[model samples]
Target: MSDATRPDPDPSIAELEAQEQRLTLTRFTHDDAWTLGSLLVELARQRQAPVAIDIRRGGQQLFHAALPGSTPDNDAWIDRKRRVVERYGNSSYLVGARYRAKDTTFEASSRLDLDRYAAHGGSFPITVEGAGVIGTVTVSGLPQLEDHMMVVEALERFRDS
Candidate 1:
């Protein structure tokens, strides 16, 4: 694709931070988790995207699903990505982008066990108006960006609804 036809670059770290600020929820209940999780599942099915979706509040898992063609490996990825969100209180994609923006990798700089914590995309912090980051919503089985976008899109729709 020509430069003009090329997709825009991923948002900058500042832009991603702004997105986190903007996406905060007024409230998040168990029912909201169910609505959001079901929305994600519906969207993925519409796209025929094989993926695993997970929603958690602190140590409590609120919702989870493994779509057609998804595998146990996607569950592993969900855990790793969710760990990143829990640790940083930021979206996993934003954390990874921050490292990349500094011309480094999370694995190289974090000194954390790669098997336990993945700073890859797909996991987003679920921040409430005043509760801070109460949980995480994550997806796996797609490319990092696509996985992240899927969660983002689902959240936006949920928020609007």
Candidate 2:
């Protein structure tokens, strides 16, 4: 097939929605924050990654950290990505991807301040079975895709363990 006819590897909206459904937890607690946050930090450390990580429930933060080399910019990105997850009830990466697929921009339709909220990556909603999304976990520093992947990988490991 010609390059023009080749299918894009990027996921569709349906696929992104499925990811949100699959990553949801039946229950979440402060204990989970300890476990996941520790694991996330360790993972970044092992990779020698300079990143900012955050886990929050409602309006309160349960865990937050910034590795060596992480700067205030990283912190700002974390806040932006976290808000993206909260606003979209999905991964920040997925929300951005959805807009990319539609050939639209998040800032155009969202009407929220682009400076305060980012549609980049590395944020996921903390969804409980009956309670819905109560908070968000976000990582920032690496490339958007890598940031998103690391968060997802950590969550997957934590859930399966």
Q: Could you tell me which 10 consecutive residues in candidate 1 have the lowest summed lDDT?
A: 7-16
List pairs with backbone clashes in candidate 2.
Answer: none
Q: What's each prediction's TM-score?
A: 0.96, 0.89
lDDT (10s digit) by residue, model 1, range 19-64: 7888899999999999999999999999999999999998999999
> Residues 1-161, candidate 2, lDDT per residue (tens digit)?
99899976565778767767877887889999989999999999999999999999999999999999899999899999888888778889898887787889787777889999999979988888899999888899999888887888888887788
Instruction: Work out how many backbone clashes candidate 1 has.
Output: 0
Model 1: residues with Cα > 4 Å off, grouped in runs = none
Q: Candidate 2 local accuracy as lDDT?
A: 0.87
lDDT of 2 at 117: 92
Model 2 segments beyond 4 Å from truth? 1-9
